[model samples]
Target chain A: MTSVLKLMGMKSMNSKAAKTPLIPYLFWILLFVIAPIALILYYSLLDLNGNFTLANYAKFFTPIYLKMTFSSFWYAFLITLFTLIFAYPTAYLLTKTKHKKLWLMLIIIPSWINLLLKTYAFIGIFGLYGPINALIEVFGFNPKQILFTDFSFVFVAVYIFIPFMIIPIFNSLDKMNPSLVFAARDLGASAWTTFRRVVFPLTIDGVKAGIQVTFIPALSLFMITRLIAGNQVITLGTAIEQQFLVSQNWGMGSTIAVFLIVFMALTMLVTKQNSKGGRA
Target chain B: MRDLLQATVAIVIVCGLLFVAAGQMQSKGSTGSKDTLTVFNWGEFIDTDLIKKFEQETGINVIYETFDSNEAMLTKVQQGGSAYDIAVPSEYTVESMREDNLLIPLDHTLIPNLKNINDDFLNLPFDPNNEFSIPYFWGTVGIVYNPNLIEDHLTFETWDDLWDESLKRKVFLVDGSREVIGMGLNTIGESLNVKDDKVLRQATDKLMTLSPNVKAIIGDEITPLMINNEAAVALTWAGQAADMMAENEELNYAVPEEGSNLFFDNMVIPKTSKNIEGAHKFINFMLDQENAAQNADYVGYSTPNEAAWDIMDPEVIADERFYPSHELREKLEVYENLGLTWLGKYNEYFLEFKMNLN
Candidate 1:
């Protein structure tokens, strides 16, 4: 990434001092990115009162934390799956449209409004007296409570994650040459076969990118769980927030965060291999 | 699926904003002129008009910030990203701040109106002889229920009644580890400061039994839930219960006959403050007989200012249940500052209880 950035900088600047532009990015990496992670690691080894201790790490390995980790991963997997299932088709369809960029822009407009407002909107939309329940009651059935449930939790998460999933898939689909599909058809391949063997294989990178973006945040989602799920879900993010802010156990929060970091790295590693394997 | 693209754009925007906020915080450590006083208190705990009035009268610029909880407030002050002159924290937080040397002793000369405060609220266990803190407001943790929603056969008065079947999936707990776990302890007759896991486990197990009745555990949103009748019963503070009752006249608050928490919010000067003189002025301004009474009327919690009672809302003053008489207060518990270890344990159990909500 640095080499690519340097090459781009050298081309843009048309000078030997291309290295100057790299300084700010290097500083940002060192200060904002690297420093915070280093702090988390350092803090993880200390107890509540700043005394050195490894109890936090041991606590993370306990059954309770282990169970929470498992549940968090399960929810993240479900959210990623649903987001991809929904976003992939929409992105593919968008690429086929005449005003694809305008349509994409229009779709992206709602996300500009505050996320909290959007989340609260879902509260009313799924409320007992809300439109969904009203629709149900229209069918002559009683309105059911829909605000605080696992379904609402996943639904809201997928809603929030959809755009992240769609953009990458859309980009990849747009990049593909339309002649590939025609070539596959010329070989007597069915439409489904063309997509499966040619189009889908090419777009695997975008899908993997979508999964990468969706799953990591889904694992750490704390606020959505509290507001929509009514605290029924305990993501690792929620636990970390509880430990840090409520319990004042920075050590424990940082230890959990370190684990989250590891999990994120593992996820990145898993998603990254597909692109490499496809390229070769 | 189009929503997916919109959300991605939103995420990018939010990340950019977060970076900007971080940058601002780094450059925000310096306090403004002495005329500026930064006051940090709980969300919606103070009257805004009074803030404007104070600013006008004192010729001091009031920079007001609100925190959702005591822990969050303490963390902000401790982190020192911004300077806060005065903070309104609950009893135990004031106590902990004192222990941590995070507070400066109050100057009584600057706050002569402290003489108007009730004797009972003056010097509590948290701060000896009223040195480090001054009572801002005091209230109880109680069950606020709507009688119209309760089944004809169902009755509730004490903390145990929260477990009643008729209230199933209707109870909303205040989102506090100490408050929720303390209510569980109150049922089993354990102190709020349970030092050991054995009693805590008992409280946790009992709370699990009450899980069927718990609809949600929340913060500021709990009030709306109660007002909308979405939650038929809520475990909330006296002031918030009062707010809910005002909005929905049918709601009734009951401090369970079993011992309940008597939370006292106090004004403390954290070490992060650069404007101690301005802070003292603000505190005194808040404590003035007329100002205190007006605040009491607006904020709706039981006032610590004895002088405020004479001119405050007659009905509120008469409601002995909300503002407990001296004898009733004898049974009310003030939350003790359980050091980090025990506090962490309480939080752990409460997290478990929350995770078991569904």
Candidate 2:
């Protein structure tokens, strides 16, 4: 192993104590992550004139914007739920099936396309003279309006976010020990009992990770909400876009963005606590 | 020590190249013969061929960028130190830019072709006396409807036609606060920029009545909706109406007699322009008869260049969507810069209208 390390020309480190390799990482985190959040927080607490005030937060908490915030949360929740439902079976089957890597690649291929492109492609599919309407005609039924509807919004959200859920869940499932399931079965547990008691518990980490990946972005989707939802449904994402772009109110936009960050952090905290409790 | 020496050598080489490049750029600037002109305009608003021709004719390099909206362009300029030599902003945005002193006064001596502009197109409220702006393309907000679909209601003579009960679930309103609210105000015979709170509320209430009829609030998507027979009526720009009319003969556009927004998009030099002479040359080249005609033909938007009218297609000239009649022009109101507070109120009403959709 040392020879292989030497062959790669990686100098051998002391076994008892290796040097810290976090300086570059710390620099990047400070610059990109810490600084941007600090800026957003600063902007959120200030008015347009740079006076420190909570007026922006007050505006955000108004009846209309408050409702938009809750609606965004609900949309995210729905998207996460649907994505998980569809992703779990697909991911589980991926682990158990042949050429798992190929299947995983296929699942990830659509996500490699730009999000705006995917949204626009869906726009074509759900358009007035789209294939669905043609299919309806084939079945001798009246065509339905699918584009710009709430269902299409959620549908596109689930489609776009499913891969995010699947990748994390697939990783955890692939890393699971078969012996645990065997042990559960050997202990007079039925197949259902084995999965319920062993498999589900083991995959909890993946589920948490999947929820984080899908829910956070779903909460802040603006383009898809506008394009697919036809701007009929307003989300916090829409509110932020309008505030910054249309109303020219940076304070309100930043306030909503900061609140979204906090909401996401809270979700992460809850999931972290639950995972820790499960491990304990 | 060897690695350090090598790194030092690399830095020295890079520095040498950068210094040479900087010196060359400096010389180019000092000579007052810089070839590059940076232009920022609305996306797909200009004919690319015209830019190429101008580059060839003047032996100048053109660096062009396109913005999707006036707000985005304004924001970029307001961020300070914009590198754009020229930007095309809408009329209302021109007013805002003038108020902020973001634009420089145009040199008429540099642009002799300015005489080609129609009398009607110049000396308006925004940048009056043609001080800071040169008119590029001017259009109006109008209704595009299918004659076959609306056979019974043949005349969509006013903005009130959009509120027709028969058109419920078949109407598409453009997703703009000013155009929508202004149409409502125009229907009620009030000023487009109505300042009174009660009048604004009344217009807002009037708008709410048409909400049930609106199938969707969309921007550019309204064209395809009408083309595909999804919508019988749409409130759209004259440019879109002309484009869609060419596609489907059944489509017709009408600038309501009650009045609508007569918008002008003008080419202006920014205050921070480094290539002011190049900007003037480009503007003059665009105002030339052949160039103006080509631009109008390619973009499908109406041209204000009087000399270009004779060169344009008779079919295009005959289309009222491209050029309104004198009576229709009389009724039209150019958009004014509503102050920030009123703009906020407009946005508030728009949001409220959207919220009530649910």
Candidate 3:
């Protein structure tokens, strides 16, 4: 009986040991995420007239603000799709290579440079009188005006964010067992079938990670769009910046920020649910 | 094990978020005392030599910060946290700041160089009798265009030329609501600070028509666009006009025949200022003839100080862009402060206009 009691005590001690580390994790969430979000929610309910009102949120529903919010989401969605399409193949190829480290270094080098500097570099390369136009002129074509367009905005956005997509996909692809692909092929599956059946399923986690990384940034990217697109293309980021800077409407800015946080939370929830289902 | 890793990742992300929040809170807590003087002004607007001169003349060390726009400068000061010792607000903003009680009344005794200012800049509507602000640099807004880009000798006779189909995707304007809307108002022979809702709407609509032709709405500097020959014509300040013309001889500046907006950037003490003596000394040093001329040369803005104008090279004064003729001056109207109600209306229209540009 004493031995059995001792065994029970040991089991209890082990359980306590497992639970203690979670205290710091819960403490962090309470201190950081929950606190600021609570503050933002409180601030969002304030009115421009300095009274506590729901008018800020009401104002957000106006056609102009609604359009801006929708456009921001739509643009971010397009950027993620394009990033995945281009990055997946590159990342897959990198995983297959003997020189994987070299390829990974090349993918990451651009990210080491400042984002603003990279955006400005693209302006030098693609501006109306830039090298691209100069080259076109050399080829006897009229110089094209590509700068300050939506096309250029997306192009720059994708270029800057491609590595984000690649790193995760590459990580997952690298971790997958090489035997799985070979087994599928040995069962008379073609190369395409082997990839679709064996390889793609394993990389869903990476794809999910890539989407989260690329989408969040693209949603809030202000400077690149502002500098490259010249503020002609409006987003929730610029709108919030304007509220604070130009409008001096802190209440409105806070409201927009609160909405953005909620949208991000909703996206994470959906992503988490989808990932749990183990389906793309 | 999976749960442990998940918790660890969650903890890491939470820590990062906490760090950012803590940093923001710490910065707010550490905003310095009233004894420290913070001077907020435009980029390259003041002479650092003059600031150093002020510090030497008066034992007060001035903390100088800068913004690129009058709107940005006013917004920060209006928010009232990092109260500035002094701010260089443009004429219209002086009116706005005064309306908001953001400015402190100036003691004329502190600025003895008030005698050196051109009579034309004194007794303005923003601060009549120069009670609250002193004129720093004054100039008219107009067009700077490259002659080589156009087939004909294109004279910027009116703001109408900005909308010409021939100049589509070749025209650039300053990305400022007040400047852009003022241009439209000037074209229609209306005051820049028009109070009538009907008149303001007309100006907004007229501006919308030219939106498609606009290649870019640039900020204070258009040197990159003009230097690269990306834009053929730009609505620019006289200082930027002079700088652009200096770079390319083919570039020229002209005051439109319809009218132009006259602006005077003035130095004023904010209500929150601590080191008033240092601010005064800085203003005095800037007003000194040699110092003023040096600053004018550096920033490329036309100086309002008669003493500074006298010291400038004859050719510089003769440059039509730097010094407009009496006839052109007659066509220019000083920007008056639109009261709070009108200014609010202006902000609304401006926001709508910017939003619709997409």
Q: Best TM-score goes to which candidate? A: 1
Interface Cα RMSD for all candidates?
10.3, 4.4, 4.8
> What TM-score does structure 1 among the candidates reach?
0.91
The top-ranked prediction according to DockQ is: 2
* lDDT for each residue of candidate 1 in A103-198, tens digit (9 for 90 to 100): 898877876888899898888888777899989999999978788888999999999989889999999999999998999999999999888888
Model 1 regions lying over 4 Å from their true place = A1-24, A273-280, B1-32, B153-155
What local distance difference test score does each model get?
A: 0.87, 0.83, 0.79
- The 10-residue segment with the lowest total lDDT in model 2 chain B: B25-34
> What is the RMSD, in Å, between candidate 3 and the native fold over all Cα?
7.2
Worst 10 residues of 3 chain A by lDDT: A270-279
List ranges where model 3 is wrong by over 4 Å.
Answer: A1-32, A273-278, B1-37, B52-62, B78-83, B325-330, B336-348, B355-358
Better of 1 and 3 by TM-score: 1
- Over B160-190, each residue of candidate 1 has an lDDT whose tens digit, in order, gives 7888887878888888998899998999998
**The candidate that achieves the highest lDDT relative to the unseen native structure:** 1
Docking class of 1: acceptable
Question: Over the stretch B1-358, how does candidate 2's per-residue lDDT look in tens digits?
Answer: 5555565566678779999998886666445446888899987688999899999999989988988678778888888544678999999899999999999999999999999999988998888898999999999988889878875665678777777777867778787888888877887889887777888888888888888777777877776667877778888888888777777888888888877789999999987677889999999999999999999888878999999999988878877766887777887888888866677678777877776665
Please report how far candidate 2 places residue B321 from its true position, in Å.
3.5
Which residue pairs in candidate 2 have backbone atoms (N, alpha carbon, C) closer than 3 angstroms, thus clashing? none
* lDDT (Cα, tens digit) per residue for candidate 3, span B17-117: 99999778545434533235678988877768877776676655678899987768887776766657789999888988888888888877888887888
For candidate 1, the lDDT comes to 0.87
- Evaluated at residue B288, the lDDT of candidate 3 is 83
